[model samples]
Target: MVPLSFANQEFTLTTSGALYWPGERALLVADLHLEKSSFYAKHGQMLPPYDSRETLERIALAIRETGARRVFTLGDNFHDSEGSARLEPHAAGMLSALTRATDWVWITGNHDPHMEARAGGEIAEELEIAGMVLRHEAKAGETRPEFSGHFHPRLQISVRKRRIRRPCAVVSTSETSGGRMILPAFGALTGGMDAADPAILAAMQPAERIDAMLPAAGKLVQFPLWRREQNLV
Candidate 1:
């Protein structure tokens, strides 16, 4: 099921908990550390090397399903400077095919500010389109709404009184006057930190406006962000 929308717009930003702009026919993803597994493997951490493929596949599917013409990434597109260089041949092919026609935009993130220049896309610290601003980090002071990804938002969803701590899209209603939405990490293997994190949680209001939920196969399970103690990552 698609996640519900908070703002009334033509795009129907399906709360699939996935950041999709139906109006622009664009798919938005953030924090896709494409070669993170390889980065770890080099350090002897022994992670599955298929992360690049998996991440790209999911992104591909999302684009196809949304019929998106463009893709906007919030940041952390690569684990490090050497991430794209170490990709397995097949994974590289997958990525190549995925971006053959669609336009890709990579906003500067802390992990790789030069990603746009190095990753076959345009690079910028922030983007303003159709009255909305895009960036890697939420601007501390802004009047209009902003979209970004860095802290993968997740919630502690309760089912039958049992809590399931899972990653989710975190939107901030307080910052930017309820104009900021934090896109969840798009990396297939990336984990999230708690939305209640001091640095991240401060953006939320204590009066229960935050909507945290996990998109299960059939339902979007909702929960309060402040009540959970478990970390999303």
Candidate 2:
């Protein structure tokens, strides 16, 4: 885990794509997309069916590492609305134990907008805590400190002639209000978008600067993504 400062608050960003907020004793992860493999199988595209178990295990490890008493899943807790019903017994048991261990909140996302509490957590469309907004997708023109998921931003770079892509958090800073951030997807089966994708840049608009961040070798590395053009007098 590496320390990150955003919106004047301290957070720990784990390489596994989980964020731990010490102030709230909370672990925030995005886009679990649980049962994603099952969703694919339903469409005749068979994939390894242990995605949920793996994802849950990762989350469990993060919780243990952080000693977080609360967990807030930014969005897309499941791949589909019916995903909870399809959880294999073992995965289901794992999820149940995790939820029971902490105060869990699942924010609805486009993929799981109708998600319920069947998976042993409270369901919410969004949350406002400590002057920050937590939601599934970042809203353009939002002025508050915001944390969201959906884009699954990743940083792609060439090193020694080899192209490497790693999941990263995209953060936007503004002069007027608390900054905003779009967290990387934590799902085992999830793919990522380029950190500088236009959609992501647009969603973080009304900002002076934006960057993609990830932990590397015990240090936080930042890659500039977008910067507002300055006017010449």
**Which candidate leads in lDDT?**
2
lDDT per prediction?
0.69, 0.95
- lDDT of candidate model 2 versus the reference: 0.95
Candidate 1, RMSD to the unseen true structure? 4.7
Model 1, 1-233: lDDT tens digits are 36455444443233333466766777778888889988888888998789988888888777767788888888888887567778889988877766666887777688876553433666677887777788877655565667778888776556899986777766655423534667778888788877767766655433224556556665665655553234334
After best superposition, candidate 1 residue 171: deviation in angstroms? 1.8
The parts of candidate 1 lying over 4 Å away from their true place are: 1-3, 10-17, 116-119, 158-161, 174-178, 204-208, 217-221, 226-233
Give the per-residue lDDT of model 2 (tens digit) for 1-233. Answer: 99999989999999999999999999999999999999999999999999999999999999999999999999999999999999999999999999999999999999999877776989999999899999999999999999999999999989999999999999999997699999999999999999998999999988999999999999999999987874213
- Highest-scoring model, TM-score: 2
TM-score of each: 0.83, 0.97
What's model 1's TM-score? 0.83
Total backbone clashes of model 2? 0
